[model samples]
Structures are given as structure tokens and as C-alpha cells.
Target: MQSNHKKRICIVTRSLSEGGADRVASLQSILLNNLGYQVFIVTILNSVSYPYKGELFNLGAIKEKNDTILGRFNRLLLLRKFLKSKKIDIVVDHRVRKKPFSEYIISALVYPKKTIYVVHNHAIDLYFPPFKWLTKLVYKKSKAIVSVSGKIQNLIFKKYGFRHLETIYNPVDLDYIDKQKIESVTIESPYVFWYGRFEDEQKNLSLLVDSYNDSKLKSQGVKLVLMGNGKDKDKILSKVGELGLTDTIVVLPFSSNPFPYIFNSKFTVLSSRFEGFPMTVLESLACGIPVVSVRYDNYEDGVLKHKHNGVLVENHNSGALAKGLNLLVGDEKLYLSCCENARKSIESFSMEAIALQWKNLIEK
Candidate 1:
């Protein structure tokens, strides 16, 4: 590809804050730029710093004056005009189109020659009823539909009747993850680390916490480390306090870099009820850390294999999660095997490899 003749690619999203989709957008922009593509990121809300090392253009913030009838129409008008003026070759929209109403508006107004919609959630229940008609119309108009996992693609096809969707697993930048020379942090006893937001319901933190509290692992000094802040932090903290796990559990906020913790920890745990291929699993594997995840449709097949890279527990089962954690932390040989396998498993999903995938797809 000629450097100067590089295609102008724009990624449009609601925001660039901490999330898997946002991170993917940033990484794609950086990788595409390195491959000699002129990239621009347009945000409809919140000005988030471009997390990728590439050229980023913010197309002004979304101005919502009030909840008046004219106000809504004016905002849509502004967005439509902005889309027309950009004259970009491709526009990739990354946002949930739950209701057909909004999808209809976006399809009718912001018409691009090649518009791609990337779906990152599997909640089919939310895409029906009030906006059923609009939803079908928008999907029909979409040039390409991208899902983060095969599970999501299947859900879209089976429930929503969209068969043309493509599955692209989230990519990790192994190059940026700093692997520390320090040997794993020596804990006097084995510890089970859960490094993510404290939202007990969605993240299923309570399941892990209750399981650990009632397991033999607790008697053996298996500690739970909770990282990342959220709306439910206070409730989680209170629950921990009530359970008298203040000494056994630790809660921390989000980190700009979470690799050091991943490196020091023995193993990572993901307890999400649902996911669109989480980047955290990829990040943990890149750092040579094993993971124990709730068996989700996509993640089980993609990341957590029986004993290969990580362990997959039955979904929403505290006992299963606890058992998986105990096995990894208690059995030294199994832990080592899992760590080694995790490191090897992530080779194909590295940034360079994924960039080539994106390049081939875009150029096609």
C-alpha cells in the first residue's frame, strides 16, 4: 500500500473511555496507522484521550442543549451534516442499536458508501418490541456487520436473522505489555486474584467472594484481590466487611497499567455474566497469567479451554468457580502448565497478526 495514497478510515463511537470496544478502536487505529492508513476517530460524546499511538481527530463533542423536541432533531442534523462533510471512504459505527427507531434514524440520515456496524453485546432481549421494525431496516442497510465472537455472530443470525456478520476476536498488544523480570510475587500461601470492577451482579464478584469464603481455600490462606472501581464498590466493600474478609480480601481502583498486578498475581479470574470477548483475558494471557472464567458461549471456546490455557467453570455456579480457583492455586504443576499454555495461546491474537487481518479485510 502506498503511504500517501492510504485510505482515509474513520472509527465512530460514543466515547473512548475504559472499555473493550474503545480499546479495540484505539488499537485498530494504531495498527492501521503503522500499516500506512490515515486514521481518524470521531466521538459523539465525552472527549477521551486517544489510547492508541496514531493520528486521531475528534469531530467536536455531542451537544445536547435540552430534552426538547427541537433540541433532539438539531443534534441529529448536526451529526448528519458532519458525516456528509467528512467524505471518508469507510465509517465504522461501534454502538448498540437496540431499538429499530434509532437505527432507522441513523440509516436514513448518515448514509455512507461503506458503513460497518460492530456489535459487542449478546443481549437479544433488548433489541425487540418498540423498535423491531426499525432494527430490521438498519440491519438491511448495513454494508457489513462485525461481531467480536462467533457466539455473538450466531446469536445475531439465529435471533436477529443476520447471517452476513463476521467474527473478529479482540486483539491484544503483547508489545506494550511489560513483562517484569521479577519472579512471581511470593505469597506465603496460594492466593486467588480477581482483578476487575466490583459490580457483584454483572461481574459475578459476589459469586467468587461467597465461594472463596466458604471453601477450603480460605482456610489455606487463598486471598481474593479485587481491582477496578464501579458503582457497586461501596456495597461490595460493605459485604466484605460484614463477612469479616477485610483481612483476606483487598479492593483497589482501576490502573492505567494493570500488567504489573497481573504479573505479580498467581492467576486471574473473570466472572462476567456476559461478554463480547473481553480484552482482560487476552491481557492476562499475554502476561503469562492463567485465568478462571465462567463458561460463556464465546469465551469458553475462545480463551478458557479445560486444562490448556485456563479453566472454564459452569456459568453462575459459585462452587464451580471456587473449585477451579482452588485447583489452579493448590496444584503447582497445573498452575505452571496453565501459565505456559496461556502464553503460547496468545501468539495468534497479537497486535501485528490482528492488524494484518484488518488490513486484508479492509483492502478486500
Candidate 2:
């Protein structure tokens, strides 16, 4: 078989910030580049924070006065021209098609010929509200649909008839995580750690604050560490202050390497309302730390196997979520059991294994 190493590949996404998919795109670019392919990341907003091995193609540089109708049309048309001129082979896009007139939809218009759509969310309801028909149109034009989890794949096909879909779980760079974990770090206390954006809509971060504020863990001198940033950062910080947890709740900035934080934490906690497959849980487990997370489609299956690897909260409410956190952080026997199985449970999702799946998809 002739090798495709000399072939050019492009990954299109809005930016590498605020979410896990962007991180996945960055990791994929690095892995593909290492595999001898010429990889290029085409980010609309140049907001890249994650590490990659590819040359960046920032379309956000070519901007106008504002995002007017004419401005959008010009950007879309020019982007199409640029993609065509590059003669890229197999563009894999990891962005949600927002609307009929958005950049995502515009790319969907041009990418079907050479693009495989990677769906990151558990559902596409965030973007499709008034124009639900656009969902069908976006997928209809996709060469193939790659869901991050089997549950997400099933959810997509169940709503919209069967299509060319495949489930490729997110890749966790275990080597990078392990290397970072050993690099001496300092955390004053054995805190209950939670990271990712402060978005209450998806992550439901307020639940964490409420639960922590009311929990016996705080009275016992255990701290709650909140890291990462987003649009709702100020609001969340303010909520913590209002609840008089300004000292108990420690908020830190977003980090590229959070393994050290996860390594030293008592146990990780997730209060997400919904998720495709959270990277934090994967990374925490990879570091031999258990997680107490809200029950979701992906978390319960192979990772947090309900007291096997980590405890699963049956409800999304603050009380239920707090109880799960307390169980994992407070109980020594169960916490030790979860920690014993944590690293072993997520071995299949390692970057080495999952990268092969991506290689097959890209070559196909």
C-alpha cells in the first residue's frame, strides 16, 4: 500500500478554548503530524491555547468592521476560496453548524466534498432552535459523522435517520499527563478539585458551590478548588463570595497542564448537566484519582462504573451531587477502591489506542 504521509490534511474549528473538543482537535493535529502526515489547523478565531504540531491557519485575521451580513458573506466566500486553493485532502471539522448563515454552516456548504464532520456535543440543541431543519441539512452534506461516544452516535441517528456514523471516544494523552504529574507541584491543601469553564448552563457549576457551601467537608477543613475560565467566571466568583465561601472555595486560572492539580486532589468532582465525554474525568482517572460525577450517558459506562472506578450521582441537584462528592472524598474505603480502579478503567481511551482509530478514519 502506498503511504499518504505526503498528503495534506486540515482540521477546522472555531478555536481551541472553552471546551474539550478544541483540545481534542489540538491533540489530533499533534498525533497526525507525528504519524508523518502534513497537518494544518484552521481556526476561525485564532484563540488557540492547546498544543499542536501543525501550522495554524487563522481566518479570524481577515475580518471587517463588524459581523454584518456583508461581512459574514465575504468571510465565508473567501474561506471557501482559501480551502480550495490549498488543495487539502480530507478536512475533518470539529465545530457545530450554528445556523443557515453562520460560518459553521458556510463551511458545511463547502466541506462535504473533503470533510468528515466530528460532532462534539451530546446533542445539537445549543445551535439549532428556530431553524431545526438546518441540522438535517448539515449532516446531509457531511461525508461522515464522527461522534465522540456511542451514546452520542445513537442519539444523533435516533433523531435523524441512519447515516454514515462512527463512535470514536476522545483521546486522553496519558504520557503527557503522567509526565506533567511528576513535575513537582504545590497545592496547600488536599482539596476537592473541579475544572473546566464556569458555565452554569452545561456544567451547572452553581451546584458545586451550593453543595460545597452546605457540605460537612468544608467544616472539616477540606477546600474546594475551582479552575478554568469562561464568560460566566465573574458570576460564579460572585456567587461564591455571596455564599461566604470566598476563602473555602479557591478559584484558579485556566491551565494547560492540570495534572499536578488532579494528582494532589483528594478526589475530583463533576456537576455537569450533560456531557459527550468529559476529559477532566478521564484525566483524573488517568492520574489514579477517583471522580464523583453527575450521571451522564458516557461517564457511567466504562469510566466511572458506579463505585467501581468512581461514584455516580443519580441526580443533578446540589444535594445529590454533594452527597456523591462527600462519599468519594469522605469515605476512606470506597475512595481507596475507586482510586485502585481509576487508572485501569481508562486505559483504552489513551492517546496511543484512540489515535489508531483516528488514523483509520483519516486513511479511509
lDDT of each: 0.71, 0.78
lDDT per residue (tens digit) for residues 1-364 in model 1: 2344487777877656555667778777788788888777776565474376544445444453354667656666766776667656777777655555555776666657577778776654433325555566656666677877777778878766865677777788886785442344433434556665556666777777777776677677767777776678898888889999998887777654667777777888887787777777888888898898887646644766777878888876778877888787778888889988988888889887777777766776
- Report residue 89 deviation for candidate 1 (angstroms): 1.7
Give the per-residue lDDT of model 2 (tens digit) for 1-364. 2245666888987787757888889888877887778787888775767888877877776553546778867877777776778777878888766555564456466663656878777755542324556567655665578888787788778777647888898888888888888765556776889999878888888888998886788888899999999988999999999999988899999887788999998889888878887888888999999888887545543367888888888755678887887787778899899889999999999777887887887777
Measured over all alpha carbons after superposition, the RMSD of each candidate to the real structure, in angstroms, is 3.4, 2.4
The whole-model C-alpha lDDT of candidate 2 against the native structure comes to 0.78
Regions of model 2 farther than 4 Å from truth: 1-5, 63-68, 103-109, 127-138, 184-186
Model 1 TM-score (2 dp): 0.86
